[model samples]
Each structure stands twice: as structure tokens, then as C-alpha cells.
Target: MSVADAVAPPRIRCLAVDDEPLALGMVCAFIEQTPFLELVGQHDSAVAALQAVHAQPAIELLFLDIKMPGLSGLELARVLQNGPRVIFTTAFNHYALEGYKVDALDYLLKPFGYEEFLRAALKARAYFALLAGGAAPAPVPPAAPEEDHIYLKVEYQLVRVTLADIVYVEGLKDYVKVHLASAARPLLVLTSLRRLGEKLPSRHFLRIHRSYIVGLGHVQAVARGTVQLRGQTLPVSEGYREAFDQFFNRWK
Candidate 1:
């Protein structure tokens, strides 16, 4: 199925909450610039976000941090009077169980790049569309199933890019940095961090942080605090720790 066919809905309302001001700002900024998304408000603390939720009932999506100084994001979610759809953000992987318990729309690791963010957003959009009855059933595979790929808009041209050729993606303000084996420099695409991820294969990609995605094969080594791939060093977010272990253990 084509990417547009996979994502038929037009728009979604979103909010972001994180203890770190930079992280919160980043999420809010991204939401504001996205075509299919609206930035309802931003919170540096879960407590504050809760208050906003009460005042503004239009918040349909939440980009939350699992860890916060005063009240943890997960705890805040538990006490919300009328909660919006949650997309939990964290620096550690240990909270995956708790996050899933709440059926959070998506879980994001800290320092996640835009493409990774887009992937989570797409999943959230899909869920909301189904819940709202605004989406149609998945198109049946053609008589002969074909390999999946994505069409990316580069400047004025829509380029066909193979999913497997992707090594990693980075989020630049108002743009996405896409890395490919053939290109010397990563290509920048104008798209939401979460939106680009919708076109990628879930099994092959994982958001270890808010700003980076390490291809399973391209990953050369991973040690405490950092991962080495294609001669670049990538930091690991604390929230993804549990998920990282799970990922490494499966392959080893």
C-alpha cells in the first residue's frame, strides 16, 4: 500500500511534557511545525501538563517523559481526570512494562531524532483514527505481495527510497537528516520527525533516543552511554536502557 493509503487521517492535536526544558521545547516545536499535528501546549512538568489538560480539553495526544522531578510522567498519567492519548517519552527502557500497562500510544527514548519521532506519531495517528472511526480498513495485499518501500519528497521531486538503505536519521529544526549508503552527506527532508517514521519498517528500526536511530546491522559496537556506528558516536537515552538490552539480547 502507498504511504498516503496507510495514513488517511488529516490532523491530530498534541501536547508535550518533559522535565528538561530543551526536550520539552523540541517536542513542542516539532508539533507546531508538523502538517498533520497541532501543538496544544507545552509542559516542563507533568503536574503542569495536568493543569493544562483540565483548562484545555482539546489535547488529544500527549508526548510525555517517563521521568520527571516532582511527579513522574507515568504517575501523572494515572491521575489525569480526562487523559488524552499518550506517547510516553523517557531516557530509560525499564519503564516499558509500565508504559504498555497504560497502553500508551508510543514510547520514545530521549534524544530521539525526527524520523524516529515520526514513526511513533504515525502509530498514534493510526490508533486514534481507528478509535474515532475516521480510518478505513487496511488494504489487502495485491495478488503478489511486494517488498515495502517509501516515497520521500526532496525539494520539488518525490524520490523513491528503499527502506533497507537507511542507516540512521537525525532531526534538524524544521527538517529531517536522512542517511543513506549511497549518499556522502545525509539528505535533509522537510517533514515532521514523527511523520517520516510512518514510512519505515517497525521491526528494523527502534527509537533508542529522540534524535538518533542505529541500524541493527550498521551498529558496530555499543558500550555504556554511547553506541558506535559508521564511525559516529551516538548517546543512549536512559528510558531506552531496558529496550536496548532486549534488543541486544535477541541478536546475541
Candidate 2:
């Protein structure tokens, strides 16, 4: 075999579950087109998927739907022990936060085309490749932030707040609540965690979870891969752990 062929891992065994027939078909089509993925089966319900996983323990990846009739995909994921790694495909963006809580590999917002599907699929492939080879991917290096203050819209008003005043940020669907050291209540604004992450000074802030971004200056402690703020404890996911660790090590 050629060097590339020799080094390439075997095709990842996968299954798909979605209540929507068209959406499920798209997932199946994506798997079929991807040379590195092998679609073992596709089901219309989480219940069927449970049986499939039980029968075929070799399923390494699952394209699951979050909203199903009986057993929701999230419910199935919660109950299944040692189930395949999940990549949730859903029409609702609100479930993005919940998906990470269950440690999903990735979340694909519905009406997502092949390109978006391929991106999520690629992440799963890399994750499985690392698991099979006993190698972890390098963590992304954190960048220095130069901005001191950020502005946000709250109740039809633009509020300017200093970066040092921020304790942390909490994401809820399309909106984020900015907790500050000076304010009694968090500032609520309609924006995504991803967008806020980019706007914030990366050096002083870290996205510790899918739903949380914490100011490094405000972090009192980190225990068990979780960041302890003044009153809240935020989880640091495996994907963001490396960067957070590197940042913490430098600060300490």
C-alpha cells in the first residue's frame, strides 16, 4: 500500500438517527459521499438507534437527531452507556448548548448543507483517529487581547463596560448574559457565544464551555477541569481544555 493508504485508519463505522425523513436522508447522503465514513445503518427514531448500537457495538460515530417522537436523541444519549460518539443534527439552535452538556462531538443546525455536514463529520473522524491511535490533538494556542472595553446592547441601549469588570459570560440560545463585578444583575444581550468569544480579549477571557466564557482575572480556582468563578462553576470541555490549561499555566 502507498504511504498515505498505509497510515490512514480504517473507515469509521457510523449510524444516523433523525425523525425527519429528508434530514435523515441528507445525513445518510453525506456519509455515503465521505470516503472515510462507513454508514452501517440509519434509523428514524432514537429507540431504533438504541437497538442498533446494542447489536452493532462497532459503531464509532452517530449522527443523531435531538428532537424525536418518543425517546429524544438527547435522552437516548444520556441513557446509553458507552454509546458511539454523537454529532447532533437538529433544526433548533437552542439545543446547541444542551448538546455540549452531553459531550456531543459537534452540533449541526438544520437546513445545513453538505459542506457544513462534512465539517462536523471531519471533526468526528479526527476524534476517532486519535482514540484509535492513542494520540491527542494539539490544543489551540490562546491569543493576547488588546481591547479594554466592550459594548453591548441591552433594552435598546448601548452599554460600554470595561473588560476588567467582566466576571464571565453565560450563553442561552442566541443570547448571552454578561456578569460583571460592578453590577448587581448580569447584562442580557442577544448575541451568540461564538461571536462574543471573538470580540472579547482572548488573553483575559477563555471559552471554558459551550455555554460559558470566563475572565481569567476573575477565576478563583480550577478544579476537576472546571473553572470556579465568584459564585458559579463552569465546565471546561475536552476540546477547550488544552488551551485553557496552557493559559492557566502561564498565568500561574
Candidate 3:
């Protein structure tokens, strides 16, 4: 075998789906140009893509478009809860929130350039690499002051969120829903709970469960195996129970 073949990185099998022929073609082209991505199939409908996914269980990634005729991209993602990761490509920016809700790896706006596409592809590569037990890349340095506030990618914009306003954070696979005191709906961002936990000030936020992090100041009551905030009760997993108890004792 050639040295190049032996040294080549493992390619992530990918499937592209878009109702528009041009859009579908562009996505497939991008996948082909990416060295770490292998284009396995291209389909113009979500149903066909679903079929492909079932037939080809080796597919690790999906470039999905949000708005399709019979089965929308969002619907497909929800149905494939344990399936391959998704990277949404769509013209409508409004679907960004929905995409995150379904735990998409990244969202590429319509008319995106190759640079944007490559950035999204790299994210997928890193994600799969981590899953394969590869060394993780260093976290990006926070742009804003880590103490006072931090910036979160909300939809297409980076919104500065004050540290104190956060009541809690709920982890959903590849996304986190930041529950704020000033907002009715939680702001969903594309990040893992462990990574976000590192960004938050440990003094104010304590992880109660693998899927939850609570702001100490917002917690009203601490009961056995649970904590209450804003009329909502959250579990305190066995792993974090000891640390939680220590924090609870400090206030008593």
C-alpha cells in the first residue's frame, strides 16, 4: 500500500438531502471535496434519505435541509434520535432554533461559501474523533470576560449573557438550553454540558446531574436527591450528590 493511503484519516460516511436539486448537488460537492468526509448518498427528499440511513447503517453524518415536502428535515432528525449526527443546510435562518432542538452538529445558512462549509465539516470531524477516543482539541478562549458574562450563539447572532441571569442549564445531547431569569423560553446553544461547565464560574454554578447545572443563587430549596428553582425540581445525580451536599451545608 502507498504511504498516503496508510496515513490517510478515516473518512466519515455522509449523506446529503435537500428537496432543491441545486442545493442537494452543492452539498454533495462539498462533501466530496472534504478529505475527511465521504459522500455515500444524495437524495432530494427526507424519505429517501431516511431509507438510505436505514439501509446504510455506516453513515456517520447527514447534511440535511429543514423544509421538505412530505418529511421535513427536523422531523427526520427527531425520528433518528440515535442515528448519525446532523448538519443543517437551509435558506431560512428561522429554523436554526429547531435545528439545535434536534441536536444538530452545525447550521449552515443558505448561499454559504466553501469556507463556511469547511468550518462546519471540521466541527463534525472533531466530534466523531472525540467519539472515537481521539485527543480533543483545546477549547476556544472565551471572547468576553469569563467572570461577568459570556457570549452564546443564539440563532445566527452571538448574544452576550450576564452570568447572574442564568438560573440553570439543561444539557440535551450536543446542545444546552440556558434557562434565564429574564426570559420565558430557554436559549439553546450548540455546546456540550461539560464544556459549558468549564466556562461558567464554579462558585455560582454547580453541576447537579450529568444533564443539569444549576446556579447556586437561584436554587430555592435542596431536598434529598433534588433541588428546586423557579417552581421546577431537578435531579441531583448520585455522582454529584456529595459535592451538592457540601454546598448545601455551607449555607446552613
Best by TM-score, which number?
2
**Which residue ranges in model 3 land beyond 4 Å of their true spot?**
1-8, 137-252
Candidate 1 per-residue lDDT over residues 1-252, each given as its tens digit: 899767566578888887765456667766776777888778888889889988988788999998788889889778762579799877566798999888787787654556667777777776777887876445333334334457888899988876556678887778898897667988778997677776665566666777776655356566766767678888889987777777655323
Q: What's the TM-score of each model vs. the native?
A: 0.51, 0.54, 0.53
Superposition error at 5 for model 3 (Å) = 6.4
Which has the better TM-score: candidate 1, or candidate 2? 2
Write down the worst ten-residue block by lDDT for model 1. 139-148
lDDT of the candidates, in the order given: 0.73, 0.81, 0.85
Candidates 1 and 3 compared: the better one by lDDT is 3
lDDT of 2 by residue, 167-200 (tens): 9999999799999988999999988989988998
Provide the lDDT at 52 for model 1: 92
Poorest stretch of ten by lDDT in candidate 2 = 137-146
| Candidate 3 per-residue C-alpha lDDT over 55-85 given as tens digits, one digit per residue, 9 for 90 to 100 | 9999999999999999999999999989999
lDDT of 3 at 128: 82
Q: 240, model 3: CA deviation in Å?
A: 65
